[model samples]
Target: MGEPLGFNEYSAGKAIVIELKGRFDASVALPVKNRMRSLLDDTPFIIADLGQISFIDSSGLGALLASLRHASRRGGDLRLANMTEKIQQVFALIRLDHVFKIYPDVKSAVQSLKE
Candidate 1:
């Protein structure tokens, strides 16, 4: 088996940072979306830290976009941070970089939500 996907959450003021580790492909996209849905109830500000994400697919990107829409409906936004070069390239290629507010690190992401 491959490395199991993991989530580590951190609270920063009104924003929540969720660190995603391992593959973020089809296998885990549903679960990831479900988890973020529940978290959105607590606060709409969410930051997905992708520094440890080893892989991602279209499903993963869809999950993120869905979560972003959910958050937007709640008058908040979903942010992305700590993306590796490969992940960054993928988002850029897909033009999702314009759809999401991406930061270099979790701290900056959180700070942006404060403003």
Candidate 2:
């Protein structure tokens, strides 16, 4: 019995911010991916706020990549912000750090999206 993964979606200007919490592992990846896909279908941009995410696994990483691709197909984009050191290391190891536009804070990420 561990804490389940949690997420919240809200709009900031034209971009949508999805705040993820708890563990982002296989247990929660698919649903989150689906949510991102749905959101991207309407919104032009999405920012994954990882400030509250404590853990992530390979499946979670895969979900993110898939969602990014989906958004791109819709002429939008997916970016990340407030990543923990461990998560950052994982992305770096997988070379996703080069693929995703990561920001130190949500405000910066949103600003980048606006511009």
Candidate 3:
């Protein structure tokens, strides 16, 4: 609970890579959403690197869906990378694994989106 959800931004061609850290829950969802929204204005491709994410709840999932919808509306896309086992299970349980583009890492995610 003390850990803060944070992200680092990097550029991969036309895509933007966001390396995430800490838990993605109700407390951090809104901040992440706002930060991501700010980036949408600059690039159409967004890669969310969840390598360090330890947990994600319904609120986090909602934020991700919202980001996806927002990106889609702007002719952009949001892809997930380096998903932890816990997060992956949540995606599978909710049948969202098929809905999103998943990659082993940020580089792969960026490369996949370029194709």
Q: How do all models score by TM-score?
A: 0.95, 0.95, 0.94
lDDT of candidate 1 at residue 21, scale 0 to 100: 95
Residue-level lDDT of model 3, residues 22-114, one tens digit each, is 889999999899888899989877999998988888888888899999999999999999998978999898889998999988878877875
lDDT of 2 by residue, 52-100 (tens): 8888889999999999998888888898999989889889888899998
Residues 1-115 of candidate 1 have per-residue lDDT tens digits of: 3377899998997888899999899989999999999999999799999999988888999999999999999998999999999888888878999999999999898888768
Candidate 1: regions farther than 4 A off: none
> Model 2 misses residue 79 by how many Å?
0.7
- Model 3: runs farther than 4 Å from truth? none
Model 1 poorest ten-residue lDDT run: 1-10
TM-score of 3: 0.94
RMSD of 2: 1.4
Q: What is the lDDT of candidate 1?
A: 0.92
Flag the better candidate by lDDT, 2 or 3: 2
Checking candidate 1 for backbone clashes, the offending pairs are: none
Overall lDDT per candidate, in order of appearance: 0.92, 0.90, 0.88
Question: In model 1, what lDDT does residue 42 have?
Answer: 96
